[model samples]
Target: IDGGLLSPEAVAADPCPHGMTRELCGLLCGDDDPAVTVDPDRPVGFALALDCQLAGDSPELLDDAQLLDVVEGAERMERWASALRTRMLAVFADRHPPGSSAPPPGADSGAAAPVGRWLPDQVALTLRVSLEEARCMLAGAVRFAHVLPATLAEWEAGRIDERKADAIAHATSVLTDEVAREVEARVLPGAAAAPRRLLQDRLRRTVARVDPQGAARRHERAKADRRMSISRSDDGMASLWLSAAAEQTEASWRSVDRLARSLG
Candidate 1:
């Protein structure tokens, strides 16, 4: 679980108490419960069961013991990918220093600043994603490297998922360095086992407690940017977007609900 490689003999010596094979037990560090046997033939089933367990749901399949290996393997792969992403972003940052807005020599004259404005185009082309998606990816990588070092370390170590890392980064993005560290330190210890929404809620409370005045100030500034927009698709379906103060949005929702109920 800690990523230390074990020899085949070492793994064979430490079989799971719950009837799991040496390979599966060694890979997943044994099942959480001694009574629940992990099926060696179907590690993926155990992984699905664990997911359903985490989601407060139940799986009807095979008593939930087959999916462990697949889940653990996928998590390890994602951790490696995340680490690679950070390294790539580091290379990008090094080439396009935030302070130096000039384009690389012999590059297009259209490559103007907000430094690194043109780099995401290269990433987009390489990764087969839209320009905006690549830009967001770079932004997130930068945030992890610069503002959320502990979160980055955990992500690299495979202790937390990238989504959880994103939650921490987004929640603390508005805080000052000192306050952000404090909030991060308080919530990060148990982050590996915490659900994304629960982790986000914890981050919110920690931020409020750590810097009430700063939170209030940011809220005020954010309110100034509040607006509404709508997007329409070719299928005649439309989606509305509201960026507003929380209380204001809630009040509007309540009014709409009341009118809808009266009409009904």
Candidate 2:
């Protein structure tokens, strides 16, 4: 299923109207050739050709290594953009530090809180995002720049994406700065390629190992906030949410299940 490039002579002989040579187009559609049936496991060799064609450029025939470089280059650019945003957000927070008492442009300063309580509002208006989203972004930026310098450096270097860096930041946010750095040292190396859930699990494990008492304290605080609620959707369905101790939640779920089955 490895894709092969046509020789210059072969490409010149059977040029396709679609810009690609006939042999290249056949990689996408093999209905006429029984031996050239599509391979399910392999990526189509000329997949990126369509992008180039759509961009109004003649497709340059690329080998597998070249295609890989194209994808990696795009990802690197994305990481750079994320890094830039992080730096901008951190700068924004710094300029509007607590007790700035000056409203952002297009905002009222008459009733501004003594502290920089309007930071989220400023971010939301500037970015056209929800207040919650703005707050999360600011928090992540703060953590990235101040709390987790190594993670930030990895992200800035394009070694890891924003999500991986944020995952590390959030996981270590509860630990002391020194302990967080230790956790980062242990987990940051493999984080770039780890699946989100696996990375989160590893971060939690590392956090618990480094700060067992803090983890226990957090669990107790979380248990204190346990409650339940239900919300109705427009589709005539209601969703129930439970936040309780694990054992109690499991017992309640079993009771509900048993009652429902009895009625059935």
Q: What is the C-alpha lDDT of each candidate?
A: 0.70, 0.72
Query: Each candidate: RMSD to true structure?
Result: 9.8, 10.6
Clashes of each: 11, 2
- Predicted candidate 1 versus true structure: per-residue lDDT over 129-197, tens digit per residue: 999998888887776777678888887766787788888888998888777788889999999889988
Error of 1 at 208 (Å): 1.7
Clash count, predicted structure 1: 11
Worst 10 residues of 2 by lDDT: 34-43
| lDDT tens readout by residue for model 2, 102-147 | 6555657575564456778878888899999999898888877887
Candidate 1 accuracy as TM-score:
0.63
Badly placed stretches (over 4 Å) of model 1 are 1-64, 95-122, 130-136, 233-237
